[model samples]
Target: MRKLKKCLLVFISSLAIVLISYGVLFYFNFFQEFVTVKDNKVQWNNLPDDTFKSCYAPKLSFSSMPVTEISQTSINLLGNPVNNIKVLEKAQRYYIPLKSICTVLGFSLVKNNSEFILTKDNMNYILSNTDCIINGQSYSLRGNLIFYENKEYISISDIEYIFNLVADFDMNNKVISLLTPLSNSNKSENELTDGKVALIRLEDFSAESVLLSESGQMKFKIIGNYLNSQGIKYHIAWVPRYKSPSNNIDNDLLSNISIENVGFINTLDYLINHGGQVGLHGYSHQAGNNTSISGIELSHKYNSSEEATRSVLENAIDTASALNIPCTFFESPHYKATSKQKEVIKEYFQYLYEPNSILTFHKIQRENNNLFIPTPLGYVDNLDVSSIEKGLAHPTPGELASLFYHPYKELNFINFSKENFGVKVDYSSSSPLQQIVTSINRYNYRTIHVSDLKN
Candidate 1:
C-alpha cells in the first residue's frame, strides 16, 4: 500500500509540472515564438477560427480600370474592371466592340446574317444594321450595328438601356459615370450603415516603415486626436517585427520574445492607448527579400502556392500569440497578397482590408466567404477623388468611404487642416476627409473601430 501511495504521488508531481510548464509557455508566448523561430510554425487548424459574422454592404467586381478611385456603393459590377475599352465609329455615333462587352460583361451573343442576337441574365435582344428588336419590341436608334476590325460594333448606349444602366456624361470633364439602383432591401441595409463605420487605418505601424520615429508617433497622435475630437473610433495594424523571420526580433511584434526598452514599450503603449484599437499588419512585413520566405508580397513570402501562403500566416499568428497581441483582423502591406493567400489569411483573421480587390467602386466585397472591405481612399498615397465624389452621390443610403492614410503623405483630401477632423462635412460641399466625416454623421454611420466587428 505504501509503494502504491508513493507511485501515485510521483504521478501527481509529473502532472503538476506539465501544467505549470504549459502556463509559463502561454504567458511568455514562448512556444509560439521559439518554436516558430526554429521553423516549427503553428497550423491554422490549431488556432480558433472566430471572426465577425454580420453581413456587410453591397459588393462590386470589374475587369480593370484606367485609374483606381474611392470605393462606392452603386450598381456594382461582377468581374475584374478592364482598363482598355475598344470602340468603333459609326454614322455620327460611337459603337463599342460587341465582343469586348460580351466577354467582360458576360453576355451571350449569336450571329445570324445582317441581324445579331444577344442574351444576358435571362433576356434576349436582336439588332441589325438599321433596326433593333428587344425580346420582340422594336426601337429606333441614331446608331446601328457596324463591323470594325473584323469584330462587330454596336451602339453601347442602346445596350446600356437594355442593361438598365444610366450614364451621366460630364461634358466638361469628359467622364462617363454609370449608375445603377440597389434592391429595396439592399438599399435599406446600405442606408443604415453607409459611412457609419469609418476606418482610419495607419498602414504599416511597425519597424518596416516610419511608425517608430518621433515624427511617426507624432503623426499617429495627430490622427488619434483628430478622431477623438471628431468622436470617431478607429483601428491600428501592428507588425511583430520588420524583417525576415530569420532576422533578430525587433519592435512590438516580437518584443515578448525579448524584453524591450522602456521607451519602446512606452511608444507601443501610446500607440495601443491613443489609437482606437489594434490589428495584425503581418510579421516581418518584408516581401520577396527574406531568404526564409521568398516572395515579393508579405503573404506570398513563403512561396507562390496556398500551402506556402498559409505557413507564412502561421508565422505571423504564432509570433503574435507569443507577444500576447490580439490580431483581430488582417491587412496586407501594399495590398500585395494573392487571392489564395487571402483565403489562408481568412482562415486566421476575422476581417480583411483589401485594397487590390478585383472590383469596381471599391465597397465591401465578399469573396471566398470572407468580407474583404476595400480602402478606396488609397493607402495614404493615391487618393481616389472621383471614387469619393461618386460615393457622395451613390443612390444607396449608406456610403462606406473607407479612407486609408499613412503618416508619411503627399495629401489627397483637399485643404486638410487640423481643426476639421471632428466637424461634420457638408455633403454638397467638396473636401477631403471632412466630406467623409460629414457623410458618416449625416447618414447615421456610427463611427466604429474595426474591433467592433470582432465577435
Candidate 2:
C-alpha cells in the first residue's frame, strides 16, 4: 500500500509538471501558428514540435477555366449584397461569422459562454463548439465553432440546417450564395427544369447571316457534331438577320456567303431536320431608321411601339409558317428589347429567353415573370471562351444556359477587347466548343428547347 501511494504521488507530480510546462510554452508563444497555403496543399504549423499538420482537403478544382478566389467573386446573402457579411477560408473549409449570418438572415444571436442561442419563429437554436442544439436536442457538426482574429465564425455547412436557408457553393465560379427557402423553390408552373438543368444555345442565326455556301454548311456541321459529342439535345435561337441589303454584297471572295435565297433556305432546312427548334431572333436585325443604336433591330427596328414590334414578329412567324418551319419562341437580337416589345413578344410567342444583363445594357431587369426566362450565360463574346464563365457569378438553378456564337468566327473573324464590346477585335483563336463543354459540365446543364420548358 505504501509503494502504491508513492507511485501515485510521482504520477500526479509528473502530470502537474507537464501541464505547467505546456502552459509556459503557450504563454511564451512557443506554439506559434504558421499557416501555409500552396497549390492543392494547405498546412498549419506550430512551434516547439515545428511539424506541419495535414488537413482533410477534398480535391475541389475547376477544369479548363481559371479558379477565382471567393473574395474576388460576389456572394449573395439573401439575394442582396450585404457588405458586412464575409466568408473566410481556413483548413480548406468556409467559415462565416455568427454576427454576419444573423444580420443577413434576419436573426439575433443570443450569446452565452461557449454557446450562442438564436430564436426565430419561436424555435431556439443553441450553437456550441460541436453541436447545434435546437430546442433541447443537439446535432453534431464538424468545425462548427471557429475563432479567427478574436471573432467567432460558424461553418457555412451549419447555416442551412440551423437557419432554414440554402447554401450554394459554385465550385467552378467559386461564388457562394446563401439563399432563403423561397430562392431555392422559386419556380412558376412554366419555369422549366426541376433544378438540374435546361440547356439553350443561341445560334445568332440572323437573316443578315443565313448564308449557305460550303463554309457556312461546314461550320453548321461542326456545331452539330460538337453538340452531338456533348450529348446535348441543343436548342438554338434563330436570329433572323433579314435586313434588306442595298450594297453589302461584298462576298465575291467568300464562298461561305451568298445572296442566293435557295441556298439559305436549304441551310435552314438542314438545321430544322437536324433537331433544331426554330425561334425568331428578329424580323430584321438592323435598327432601321435609328442612329442611336444601329444594330439593335428589335429595340428600335420598324418602331419603338408595341404594334411595330408585333408586326415584325408576326412577319417572322408568317415567314416560318410559309416555309413549313416551326416558329415556337422568340429571342431579341443582341437581347435588345424594350419592356413594351417584350410584352408584345410574350403575347405571341410561347417563351422568350432574354438577357438578364448584357455588356452594353446594364439596366436590364432579370425578374423571372415566367415569360422571360433569364438568359444566364450571355454571348460567348471572346476567343478564350472561358471568359463566358463570368455569368456563373450568381449560380442559381433553372436559369437558361443561354449562350450564342457568331458563325463568322469560323472564317477570319473579329475580336473584342476584354472590357469594351463595341470596339472591334482583330485576332483571337476560336475555342467555342471547349468553353461550351466546360460550362455545361460545370453547371450540369440538361439541354432543352424554349418550347420544351413548359408545365
| Most accurate candidate by TM-score | 2
> lDDT (0-100) at residue 16 of candidate 2?
100
Residue-level lDDT tens digits of model 2 in 1-455: 99999999999999999989867854443223322223312222311121212211212211111211236544566666657545664323456678877876677888898788887787888888768877787765533466666778775546645664444444345455665532112212222132344344646564334243433533453444344445555555664444434544322211122223323443454444334566777765555442211357666444578667766776566555443345666777667788677766656654666643332121112233333555545555655565456554344322334555555554443222211211122322246654565566565444555544433
Taken over the whole model, the C-alpha lDDT of each candidate is 0.47, 0.50
Sequence-dependent TM-score of model 2: 0.45
Hey, what RMSD does candidate 2 come out at? 32.2
TM-score result, candidate 1: 0.44
